[model samples]
Target: MKKNILSALLVMAFGFANAQGTGSRFGIKAGVNFPNTSSDFHENENLIGYQVGIFSEIKTDERFGIQPELIYSTHKVENKFIKEGIAYNNDVKLSYLNLPILAKYFVTQGLSVQAGPQIGFLMKAEENGINITDHVKTIDLGLSFGLGYNFLQDCSVDLRYNLGLSNPIDFHVGDENYKIKNSLFSLVLGYKL
Candidate 1:
């Protein structure tokens, strides 16, 4: 399964590279993430994480473009729970391979706004030092909205929010069902070639 995914990415890279001749560009990005989740649980806290990615921007005109990115993102959430009369903390770390395809609208020379759909494949999940991969769903569906600024022709910075639409957790409490969805804010720097 991993080999298939790697093959697909290679094919996409080649296709995007060929598209550069028709007003497209490739870029590399790295960023910091502030991640959290919405859940039925009472006590939760966010932790700082990180992401790295590659993207291709295909320009249709001076004012409009399409940007597709493949990113490896990590998120950590601290869950506080009470066990028998004691309170304890479990730090959950989740990693994903995220794919986002955004439509960009240039409002000014260097400024743009983008919105898009994103899909994330879970790569790893852990609580403390133990693996808890099976406790959460493997696929995440989300939306992304952001503002970007391009400077010095080749350098850019972006601020984005990713909102997860689907619950990653599935469980029942007595006769009630509970859900949990992940979300995050990202600040990233990019260089285009």
Candidate 2:
């Protein structure tokens, strides 16, 4: 958690340093998220989530830019487990503070491709009718890829996928090692300021 916060600060510092003599735009963004988890005990199932944030785009050239975002995101997981020929359904909800550093390449006048790495810190977690606060891990690392269309110079829409690279749960229940993976897909509406 501390590491993720420090990394986000460093990135923001770098962005600020590079802001001199560059065209920059700040924007507000809101998005819907589809979240899932992967593990041995349960298969992935899509759950609805959302994100709201602010971002800045610093253009280095006509074809390339750097975008940094600070966002509040919700993530959920739903799965069915089978043990001893019986099935049980479980649901998990997690709230996160997410920061993403994106590199964008303009493919056309109004279209672009963006990819980046995102770091997330867990703010809250709930599972199976219980508050599993201590059982949840705080740090999350992921990669993001997206396609965007700039309808106007200051307005755009994006569809993005976030693939988790680390497990956010320490599932240790009497010598059982069951971990949950965090992944999400999002569609965002953005407007520059």
Query: Candidate 2's residue-wise lDDT over 147-172, tens digit each?
Result: 98989678999999999999888665
**Candidate 2 to truth, TM:** 0.87
Off by more than 4 A, model 1: 1-11, 83-88, 172-178
Off by over 4 Å in 2: 2-21, 85-87, 173-176
What RMSD, rounded to one decimal, does every model reach?
2.3, 2.4
Clashing pairs in 2: none
**Tens-digit lDDT string for candidate 1 (124-167):** 98879699888888889999999999999999999999999999
* CA lDDT of every candidate: 0.86, 0.83
